[model samples]
Target: MRKFILCSALVLVMTALSGAAVMAAKPVDNDGDGVTERSDCNDNNALIYPGAAEICTDGLDNNCDGLIDRADPTCTAGVCSDADGDGYGFPADPSCSYTQEDCNDTLASINPGASEVCDNGVDDNCDGLTDTADPACGTNPHASNTWQNYPLDCLSCHDQQFNEMADSTHYWWVGDTTEMANQNGTLQGKLTNSVNSYCINILGDWPVCGKCHVGRGKRPDDPQADKTNIDCLACHNEDYAMARTRLADGSMAPSLAGVENPTAEELQVLDGYTQNINAPTRKNCLKCHAFAGGGNAVKRGDLSMSGTDLHGATLLEGTDNNSDPNFDVHMNVMASDLKCQSCHVFQNHKTIGRGSDLRPTDDLARGSEVKCVTCHAGFDVDGGHAAAGANRTDADRHVSKVACQSCHIDHYAKVATELNRDWRYSHDGTPADGTNGPGHPELTIGEDLSPVYKFWNRLSDNYLLGDVAVIDPETGAYPTSRPIGDINDGKLYPFKYKTGVQPMVSSDSKLVALDTYEYLAGSGDVDQAVQSGLVNMGYPSTEPVEWVTTDTYQLLNHGIAPAANVDCAKCHGDLDLATFSELDNLGYALKGPKAQICSQCHREKNLKSDHPGMHNHVDKGVGMDCLFCHSFSRQEERGGISPCDSNATDFVDTNPFAHPECSQ
Candidate 1:
């Protein structure tokens, strides 16, 4: 009985093992491709069986081998015709596995491996993108897009633009001083011959001050300069001004400070900036102009970053008053939105507009002056100044004697400007902290200040570099720069008055062009700066020197406020205050006794009472001549004043302020 039970147990165990083998051998095809899942390479796809046909263009392993569609031995690689013999074929086939396809079959240079030729309206490379649209092309919108060779690469296709800029005042920093009364009809400029109250002069300071120049490394007038010295990116790229740094060799180069070994992501960002090229915007221009005298809004009182739109908003975040459009109507983003070039209008790189204090006449033809008449036509006529509740006739007559800026630009330095710079004291802050010690001069800045009034006739007496310094008898200060005009031939204009303490050569009384760069880069000593300056000016270092107070009058031509918003009482009402005091000081007083002059026309009138009415009686009431009591004549403007009787010559007998019939 035991032997029979053992034999039955063995049979039962064998049956169970056989059943397990049968279950394992059952066919498993999840995709239902008629092949087992183990045999198929891609079981999720029905077309990926082991012996399936390889479809070359599918980019897939149609036949389940160890290879993709193009690499399959069974698939025939498709070919295209190479008509241009450039080795690259046309009619790009996805099935072609041997080589990259060309975009244009007719031209051999239009192959996939070729370099892009910019501005030619041709796809030089077979990347389906052309010229500036190609990633390989640099920022240049013309041929030779590489920035490697610098200005030479730019000149390859932009020769005309290059030549135009080469002759421009912006590049040379000097030009014909046709408007200067001191150096009229002579070549004068700020490069090496002009002196001002700001940094004083450019002599012996080219290495530091020349960073703002458009040239590469040398001075603008350097004999070693060539076309390669031009920096095209200075005006074209907004970020270039801040991105540049002075090298050990005294040349300016794009800063690669933190990216010596750039990663792929950082390289992409740099490439994007290299490809960004555009016309000069306010942001681009303000980079140098707004920060002229070492800091923001330090030199030009009217020009500031707040004049721009998006960029200005970012720069003036904490300063809300500066960002107001009422500060400047023309440059206001919410208003006219005019650019610097809009009024200064450049033709072939020769700009048309310049202030009286500026030395160069960039456009000698004087095709256009940046005048209010350019936009406000008929401003000299009677109804030109017409407003809702204001007496505009008197305002219009004042246009003959007052500049638009005098009334419209009531205030200047919306952003603080350097009103005075004292070299005797050192600045005690971050910008002055350096290895050379604190060398920056102490600055007296003013913000939202009233402009000083002056009479100007578009002529200037700017101080030349080597000329002997002379003190103005009236102001008791050395006039580094001044406007040239009087009440007779000049109109009232606004000006920014600046002062500075500088060294003067006691032997010759000449203003020394102190080496401010030395004070900034070496030991912070004003005396050392003066010593270096004297030697550079062809004088002995031991030349006797004296500290002198110098002053300059820079023309305020920008920041035009709205005409309707002007306060007429600011000038006419307060005869003893600001405007009249300034006007009387500058020789705008009556030619003779005011009471005696009024008696000739009628009963003696109160000169101060009804000032507007009195002006109307002399101007529109009887058409009296302006020269009867003033230094200048408005006869031409009033159409040859009311004809007076030829026999009545004496002022006491004839009413010169009345018409012919009224005089009788």
Candidate 2:
């Protein structure tokens, strides 16, 4: 019976399919020709005999007309006339009028060829005007920025702004500024507008001299031999560049005109959107300094590793291999590449003195390194900038010294992993953020990264916090606080430069060294530099250096608990082996104020997953500081010139961990 039923069903399906094959499609006919569609010569029109008026429609004889489709809209329709007349259609059919050939119906503009006037609110014909505002006049209203439409030429109201530019260093590149003695006291000098005037004279251009000369510009003498023009190629050169440049994996940031991103057909379009983004502003300086590495190192762009490196590896029991030498720094440096602007900023001490207080030059040339006393305001005072002048050795030092940017570069934004499609056309298209996780990072970024841990389950529920601890009711102190000053090492060696060990701090709160891109680029590594002549700034060696002491920092004694049961009785308890992982959440094993511990990472630049593991977690690359990567306990912050660190500590002599980037 089952066999019979299957055969019956198959027969029924076959019959239904056969019926569909015989049916034909529907038809279109402007003229009504009714010969049952199949036999009719013109399926659209019955009114057209073998020969009749050209009543259009049907691909045949409509009204017996020989023409096809050219009826109602053309000769046959009551208004027998072509509007476009190109033999096309009304709007599209170009038959009635060729004037319809004019593509732009709005401005009534016509013809394939015409003048190309950019819509810059101006009429170029010398025929006075723009956008019909002025009738083709001889001149245009110049670029203005005044309460009453002030013209671009500032002379309209003010005198030729500081015309002595021919003699000024800022205007013509000639010399240097005087220096001061200390950060405190009125760093005296002539507070005149003469220097300011020099800049205003040549102010018509984007570079007021002060724009790029950076340290000097209008402030110092740039000299004729080294007269530099503010050219785009100087910074955004494809091969050799000073400023960070951009390229598009997917046009995230096509090179600006004046900038490098150019097409083969033509170089930067004559004044395109290219020059829109401003020249090096203080903000631009920060962009490079904020980050490190291709992305690992950064300037103003800061990241949080707590200690975890770029690839998410942590210094735990089994991950960090001790045998390797560079293992620690390679793995834990946060934003390994540091930028110059990160430290050389306005109102910041790194500028010549401990603060806005700049001093004049002494008789020597150092990397301009000093703690408190540096820039004097002017050049005619007893102990002020008046006492300052170019140091005799300044020329040699400029030639030899790598002030910064010797390595790190603010790489342009990268194309994120996104679908390849014209945004308007994509089915599920999402615009990509110009930067990726690491490709473009800030050099000195702060994180509000609330999540402590994200387990393999791909969720944030299992995050860790540094080992939690409660204040002793008796003493309200926490393990973190400002570190006391110390002359860890008194003897000074002639200064030597080393790179790769990401920085953790600066001397006297000046420049945050390792935290910059320069540090990560392996600046003056030991092999490239002499491990000699480094001098110690602590010549008097007044204070004693202190080593890490758990007894001093109360939180260091406690530890983290397991992932799942983190909030239970485990949280309040004193640290033991089980609670150690909690440190991964708070981002450290240190027990100090956030500043004390935060600065640890603030120094180093690179932090890849491969660095020496610090605590006992996977180092998800989010919860760690610079110390976890630099083996900070071993390295010293160089203040006075020094070939090698006087306070360099040989960690564990029995090394417990190693960063991945460190080669033999």
Q: Each candidate: how many clashes?
A: 0, 159
Residue-by-residue lDDT tens digits, candidate 2, 119-211: 433232323344445442323333222212211233343233223222233233322333221221222221111111001112112121133
User: lDDT of model 1 at residue 638?
Assistant: 51
Runs with alpha carbons beyond 4 Å of true place in candidate 1: 1-144, 257-270, 306-323, 380-383, 387-392, 428-436, 576-580, 602-610, 619-621, 639-664
The lDDT of model 1 is 0.69
Show pairs that collide, candidate 1. none
Residue 123, candidate 1: how far off, in angstroms? 26
In candidate 1, position 194 carries an lDDT of 83
Tell me how far the alpha carbon of residue 639 in candidate 1 is from the true structure, in angstroms, after superposition.
4.9
Off by over 4 Å in 2: 1-182, 185-222, 225-266, 269-286, 292-524, 527-664
What is the lDDT of every predicted structure here? 0.69, 0.24
